[model samples]
Target: MVHTFSGNPLDREDAGRRDDVWIDTARDDDSTRFLALADLNVPIEGESLHWLHREHFDESDLESALLLGSEEGAARFVVDLSNESASADRYVDARSAATFLSMEDAGVVAHARSLVDWHRRNRFCGRCASPLIPKRGGNVLQCGQCEANLFPRTDPVAIMVIVDGDRCLLGQSSGRMARSNFYSALAGFIDQGESIEEAVRREVMEEGGVRVGDVRYHSSQPWPFPSSLMIGCHGLAETTEISIDEKEMNDVRWFSREEVLAALAEESDVLRIPGRMAIAHHLIHDWATGTIEV
Candidate 1:
């Protein structure tokens, strides 16, 4: 299955990056659909997520807008709201919006969230401390003094299902909130100069004292909570002695296949994995159902 934000709904035309006139024209076009965000809060209406039409909202209410590209002859653009008090438009974070919106809309909204969030954080250049200006339709930021270019960033995370025979290892991160006996897959950010497979092996050993061998790539998901690319994989555990790092996880344990099945079926008294909204859920489910090669 295509993960929530893995599939994009718009065609991010690369060739149009140099067309300043086209970008400006598309932003003001009547067929343009705008997604306005403020402090990472997205606009919503009733049960549906709607985008602002170009002619509806005042131009003054927009802070920084980007050309998102066309679909079926209609242009889609994402904009940052000038202020919180500008309009009474209902707003919610990406998590809440994902629950009610379709996968395509969720993906589009996530893209918008990452873009607006990048612009909000990268207001100045690190080289010369000069204010960065939006270029290439907010896809790139340029420094006036140094002429340095900045692009949106995405952190890559290795989220894996470590299987040891009939059971799989799962843990709750030390930073995660209390989840009433819930344990998801172990994940860590990919380190510099390390391949994703190497990062997975290293993290498993560092966290739980387990040796991972034979890693298999499964799927990837775009986790838009501040922009993350989740690389989901399955790993066979060569040794499974439980010696967990307290600083890495609040709890770490092994659950049997039957236990995982019960949890996925919502009939477990011990384990409660993440819901379908997360890639971890899919990873766990695939392992539990014998779909993933161990």
Candidate 2:
């Protein structure tokens, strides 16, 4: 099972409900289609949703619709169904119920938030100061003057669950352990001109000072805090000498399968890991349950 952070209990029936509803940019005459800022369920009233763009709604019929940018400067589109408006109680606001929705819903919200933010920030061209226009149903931006086309970016990052038989590798960020026991697999950004495999090898070697071989891809998730795509993997540890980068991690060690099970069952006090909302949890869980074949 994939561990997802936000949107755990989303009502599947409510998501993408108004595929036929017309969404459009806010018009001067459209008094009801104003924007509101999303803030963890508490919306800021009278806030104008920036980065107005159009999207095609095709349920029973095809229609054009307007998508709104969230207050956090993330792109999100809501269908305007005032003509056939459903109960306000029916729609689950992303702000309030992010933590309660399913992993899929969380992923959708994260994508929307990040894309909207990208649209807002890249309003002007980098080459010359000129206005940019939306393209590809808000998936890309094109400059009017310089003609620079910018696509939606998903930053690639590598996170691996290194295993040595019954024990798994885990690390903690320095200074944050006191606030909460945050333990996760070795992770780092994929550098330019490097393959994913190369990045994985380089990151594990640099962070944990361990040599990994037979690296295998596990799974991936969209982490849209600011647009990151986390690539999860499993690696075989050839050597296990803990030499952590003091700037990146405080400590790195191997946790036995039993120890991880204890943590999952809330039976261990010495170590605590991320909740089921994180990919790290899935990576560890897969190993603990004998699902990770490596």
User: Highest TM-score: which candidate?
Assistant: 1
- Candidates' RMSD to native: 1.7, 8.7
Q: Residues 27-146, candidate 2: write the lDDT tens digits.
A: 222232322223212122223122222222234211222243323323344333324423232344444335565454554556555655565567788888798876544555779888
**lDDT for every model?**
0.84, 0.62
**Residue range 37-123, candidate 1, lDDT tens digits:** 767777778755677787656665433577666678777888777464534357888888888877878888888888888888898
Provide the TM-score for each candidate, comma-separated: 0.95, 0.72
Best by lDDT: 1
RMSD of 2: 8.7
Question: Model 2 — which ten-residue stretch has the worst lDDT?
Answer: 40-49
lDDT for predicted candidate 2 compared with the true structure: 0.62
